[model samples]
Target: METFDLSRLTDFDFEAVCKDLFEEELGVRLELFAAGADGGVDLRHLSSAGESLVVQCKHWHRSGRAKLIEHVENTEAAKVAKLKPQRYILATSASLTKGAKDKLFEILQPYVKTPSDIYGKEEIDALLRKRDHIVRRHLRLWLTSASVLNSLLAKNVVTRSQALAEEFDGTLRTYAVNPSYDRALELLESRHVCVIAGIPGIGKTTLSQVLSAHYMAMGYELVEISEDSDEANHLWNDELNQVYYYDDFLGQTTFDEKLAKNEDSRLLSLMKRVSRSPNKRFILTTREYILAQARQRYERLDRHSFDVHTCVIDLSDYTYQARASILYNHVYNSPLPQTVKQSFAEKRVYRPIIQHRNFNPRIIAVTLAESGLLSGHHESLSDDIVANLEDPYRIWDHIVRNQLGETDVKLLKLILTFMSDIRLDDLQELWMELGEPLRELRKALGVLDGTMLRSMHQYGAVHVGFHNPSVRDFLVNYVQSDIGEVTSLISMVRRFEQLETLWLIFPAPGGGPMAETYKRRRDQLEQVASMVFHAEPVNLRNSRHGKNYVRRAWLCLEMGLDLESEVIRELALEAASDADTILNASESTDLHAFFQTLARHKTSRGEEIMFDCISWAVEWIMGDLSDWNLIEEAEDFLRSIEHYDPGIEVSEALARLDSVRDDYAESAFEDWAQTHRDPVFSGSEMKEVIDHYKAIGSTDPFDMSEYDNVLQRLDEYDAGHETPFAAPRKDSAAGLAWNEVREVQSMMQTLRESSD
Candidate 1:
C-alpha cells in the first residue's frame, strides 16, 4: 500500500505539518499554539464569517486502527467535551477504519456533525499529495529525485554553456534572505515567464541558478535552453510539469546589435506554449539594459514574450537589508581567520560594505576571495575593502595585468576606444586600418585569451567585447600605458571632430567615482571639446551636440571651470528631460551653484521648459535632502528658481523631509558612531531617515544650530569612548573632562542657539 509513512513525523512535526496543510491546501489559516498549553487545541482556525475550528493532531502512528480509536476515545473525547469547539477535527497519523471514524463522530455527537472532521490515514495521504511542497520542505529524507530534473532535457546537437553550478554550490545553498525569493517563487507558481533582471555582476545569473535548484528540489523537471538557434528549438517539445531554465536568453554581448537574435522569436514561441500549458514554468535571466534594448528593437519578440502576468525579478528592488544580507552571507561563510571573522561582526567593519553605492555581490565575492590570500591584518583588510569600493575595476585590472601580454593589452585598449562591442569581421577591418597586418591581428586576439575578451555569436555575426563591464571601464581610463601610440592609431580611424568618441569612453554620466580616473585628464577632455567646438561651430543644434555638450558640461562641473554660455544653456534644455546629467556633473557641495546655473537658464528659456528642468533637478538632488546641510542648500537653490517656477514637487519632498529631523534615538546613533569611529550618519541609515520623514506630514521644527551640534557632539562623545573594532583615540581623560563641562554649557547654549 502506498502511504505517507506517518511514523517518520514526530508529535511537534505532525502539528506543524497540519498547520501547513490546512493553510496551503484548505485556504484556512490555522495558528499552532504553544505545545503544552494549547488547551486541548493544537491548531486554531478562525473564520471571519462565523464558525471557528479547533484541531488536535494525535501522532499515534504505532497504534493500529482499533488502538487509535480507543486512544482518541479515552483522552481526546473528554478534552473536546470540555472545550466545545464549533468545528472539531481529530487529525491523527495512525490509519483509522471507516467504522472507527463513524464511531468517533457519534461519540462527539452534535459537536462533530460530519464524519469527514475525523480524518484518517487515507485522507492524510490525499492532503499530502495536494500540498507535497510543504512535506518536501520539512523532511530532508523525503524522496525528491535530482535525476527527475535531469531527465527532462532532450538530447540535441546544440552544446550547453558552462553551468557554473558546481562552482557556486556553496553560494546557492547558503543564499541570503532576500524578499525577491518569495516573489520569484510565487510568480513561478502561476506565471509562465519569470525574468530575473539586474545590472552586471549583481547576481541575476546566480539567482536563476538558485531558483533552478529550488524547482529541482520540488520535483519539477529542469530543461536548459541552448544558445544555438536550432538546438534551442529542438529541446522544447511539450515537456509538461517542468521548469525550463534559460540563462542570458537575451544576450548582453553587444549594445549595437538591433536584434537579440533571430533565434529569440522561436524562444518566445516556446514561452507562449509554456504559458498555455498550466503545468510548465519558463524562467530566464538577462541584464536590465539588454532586455530594455531588446523590447525597443524587436516588436514580435516583446509582444509574444511578455504579458501583464509575467514576473520580473529586478535587482533595483533590493533594499539595504537585502544588500546587507548579500555582503553578510559572503563574509560570514568565507574561510577567513577567526580573528578577522570576529572583527567582521563589528559595526564599523561591515557598515561600509553596506553603505557603498558601488556595493555589488561580485565585487564583494572577489574582494573577499582575494582577502584569503593576504595576511589577516586590520590595516590590510580595511585597505582592501576601501580599494574595492572606491575602484572596483582595480580587482579586474589585477587579474588582467598578471594574465595578458603587451600585444593583448594594446588590442584591449583599441577595443576600449571603440566603446561598443565590435563585430569580429569589423574588428579585423579596424585592425587593418591601424596598419596591423591580418596575421598580427590574429596573434593579438590569441594573446588576449578568453578571460579578458569574450566572443559570442549574436544573430549570424560573431561579436567580441570585454568579459565584464568593469573590465571595459578599467581599460578605458587607466590602461593607457601605450596611450601615445594608441592615440595616434585612434586619430587615424576617427577624426577629433567627433568629440562624442571621447565622451562615450567615460562609463558613468555625472563624473561619478567611476569617472574619477578620467577627471585628472580634464585638460585632455577640454582640448578635444574645444577642437570640436571650433571646427563645427554651427553643429551645436544637431542631435550629435547632446553627447558632446553633456561631456563638456561634466568637465566644467567636476573641475569647477567656467561653463560656456552655449553649453550651459543647451545643457538646461537637456536637463528638462535629463536632469541626471546636471546632478551627476556636480558633487554635493556644488549642488547650490549647479542649481543656480540651471535657474539662470530657466529664466532665459520660459516657465514651461524651466519647470520641467527644475522638476527633474529637484527629483535628482533631493535624494539626500534629509541632511541638515543639504536642506539649507536646497532652500537657497529653490529661491533662485522661485521667480520662474513654483517647484511644488521639490518643496513637498523637502517639506516632508523636515518634519522628522530628530525622529531617531540619538543614543543609538551615538552607540553606532562610537563603534564605527565616524560621526557621520551612515548612507543606509540616512536613506531610512529620509524615507521615514518623506512618508510623514510636514512640521515647523525649531531652527536651532544646537540641534545640529547635538548630533555632532553625540558623535564626538562616542569617538571619545572607543571600544574594540574602533581605531583608538588618545585623549580620553581630556574628552571626559570636556564632556562634563559641555553638559552644563549645553542648556545655556540651547537657549542662545534657539533664540538665534
Candidate 2:
C-alpha cells in the first residue's frame, strides 16, 4: 500500500481531498465550504430522508493524534452539540488509534453516530488507493507523495536531473494547480508540443516546470534546452523517452539575436519531429508579447499556426480560489517564523492580496520570499504585500534600495548589461574591468543569490543570472530612472552586446520618461555612439560576428546622433566598403539591418555599394544550395532587397532560389539520416554524470532497485486510471470556508461592477 504525506497539503487542500473522497465513499454529493469561522461544518449533504450530514476535516497530521483529539473534544464537541446534526463525520489526516477514535466517539455520543464514521490517515490512504480519481483530483496529494518524491530523487543520478528534482521539490510545495496546467497537459498529450505564452510574472515558466516534472515522474528523461533548438536537435533520441524544456526560447525583452540565426525554422522543425515521435515531448515558454513580436518579425513563425499547440496563461486562468491558494502555498512554504505566518491568517490580511487587481504569481512569490526583510509588524507586512501587488514594477525596488548593499546593487546593474545569463568568470572579469574589487564579487553574489540573482553550474562553469525575468525588469526600470547610472554603464561597456543592451533599454528618444531622460543625457548618448563606432564587435559567444558591427552602425543612426561626425562617417564608410564581408557573415535579419542603415545614412557611393553587395550575396547563394537555412536566407535576402529597392532586378536570384529548394530538401533528409543513424550519449552527458556524483561526494554504483521501485509505483498508479491528464475540478471554492468564499465572491463582483 502507498502512503502519501498528507502534511504536504494545506488545511484547504486537505479539505478538498476529503470532500472528493467522501463524495464517492458515501455515494452522495457533499457541498464544500470555505475555511474560517465554520460552525463545526466543513462539508454538508442533505439526504433524501431530510437528514443533515456534517463532515469536518482537520489537516493536523503534524500536530500529533493527542492534539487532534484534544482539539476535537475541547473545541469541536461543543460546536457539534450546538448544531445537533443527524449525522457527523470526522476526517483528520492524523493517524488515530482505535482508542482515540473511541474516545472521540464517546465525547460526542449522539452526533458521532458510530466510530467508523471517523477517518484517519490510514483510512484516507486506503481510500485513495481504491479511488484513483480522488488521488488525481488533488494534485498536491500525489505530487508530494513520498513515493513520487523519492522516485524523483533516487532514479536519476545525472547532475541535471538531480538538480531539477530538487527544484521540483521546492516548486511543488508552493505551486497551485490551475486550469492552465490541465490545458497545457492536454495540448502536450494530443500534440506532443506545448508552447506556454504569457506576460511577465504570469507563471508561464512555473506551469512548464510542473509539466516537466510530471513527465519526469512518468519515466521520461528531462532534456533542458538553454540556447536554441539546435540543442534539442542534437540531443533528440528516438529510442529514449525524453521531454525537452526551453524557457524563454525567444528573446526575453526584445527580438534581438535569438531568432536571428534561423531559429524560427529550426524550432518549427524540431516541433514537427517531436510531434511525430511517440516517446518525445517538447515544452517552450515565452512572454506573449515577445512571441507576438517574433511571429511578426519572422516570416516562418508568422506562417506557422502556433495557436493549435499554444497554452496562454493569463489572469482568467487563475480563479479566486486559485489565487488564494497561491498565496496560501507561498506563505505556508516560506521560511518565515510562525508569528509572521499567523499575522497573514489573522484579520484576513490575505484578502487584499487575493483580490488586488494586479495580482500576479511572481509578485506574490517575491513579496512573501522577501517578507523577512520587512518590518515584523503585521500591518507593515499587510501593507507591503498590497503595495507590491498594486505596482509589480516596484517589487524589487525595496530589495535593491533597502536590503542590498552597494556592491550587491552594483553587481545587479552590471548584470543588466547582458541580454541573458552571464558566465561567472566573464562577469568577474567585467566586474574587475569596471574597477570593482574582485573579493567583493563573491560577497555580492552571496548577498543577492536568492533574492535578486541565482547562479548555476552548467558545462563545467558557473553561470549567474537574475532569479527571474522580473529582476531584470526591475533593474531596467531602476537604471532608466537615473541618467548618471546610464552613463556609467556606457563607460563600462567592453563589447558591442552591452551597447546593444543599452540601446534596447534606452531606445531612440520619443515620448515617455525614458525618452525624456535620454533627451537630458544627449552628450552621454553621443559618447556611447562614438564608443560603439570605435569598439570591436563581439557577439555573446565571444566571437567577432559581422552582425555586431552592422548592429552598431544601425544603433548609432537610430540614436539621432550626428551622421556628419568623423566617428559616424568613418563607421559608415567601413560598413559600406566591407558590405560583402557583412553579408557573408551575418544572418538575414542582420543583413536587413545593415542594408537599411546604409539606405538611411546614404554613405558616399552608397547606391553602387548596395548593388555590388546584393550581387555578391546572390552569387554566394548560387554557389551553395545544400542546406535549408541557406535557401531560406537567400529567399529572405532577395525579398528584403526587393522591398528595400523595387527597381533592383532579382528575377535570376529568385529563380535560382525557387529551383534548388527541392534539391535542398532531399539533401537535408540525407544529412539528417547520416547524422542520426547511430544515437549515442555525448561526451558532455558522461562528464556531467561523473561530475555531479563527485560534487555530491558519492561514487556508489547506480541503484537499480530504486529505479525498479519507481517504475513499479508508476505502473501501479496507472493500472486502472483513465488518464493522468484529467480535467481539473470546476468548483474553485471547494475547500474554502463560507465567509472567505463570500469575501472572494464579493471582491470579484466589485471588480466586475467597477469594470462595467
Best TM-score goes to which candidate?
Answer: 2
| lDDT of all predictions | 0.53, 0.69
What is candidate 2's local distance difference test score?
Answer: 0.69
TM-score of each model, in listed order: 0.41, 0.80
TM-score of 2: 0.80
RMSD of 2: 11.1
Query: For residues 7-28, what per-residue lDDT tens digits would candidate 2 score against the true structure?
Result: 8776666766887788889988
Give me the displacement of residue 741 in model 1, in angstroms. Answer: 44
Q: Which pairs, if any, clash in model 1? A: none
Alpha-carbon shift of residue 21 in model 1 (angstroms)? 17
lDDT of 1 by residue, 468-584 (tens): 565665665463444464344345333222333443343334444435444544455545444443232211111122233333443333233232334433433543355555444
- Cα lDDT for residue 362, candidate 1: 73
Poorest 10 consecutive residues by lDDT, candidate 2: 747-756
- Candidate 2 residue-pair clash tally: 6
Model 1 misplaced regions, further than 4 Å: 1-163, 168-171, 226-230, 239-241, 258-261, 301-321, 332-335, 372-379, 397-469, 476-756
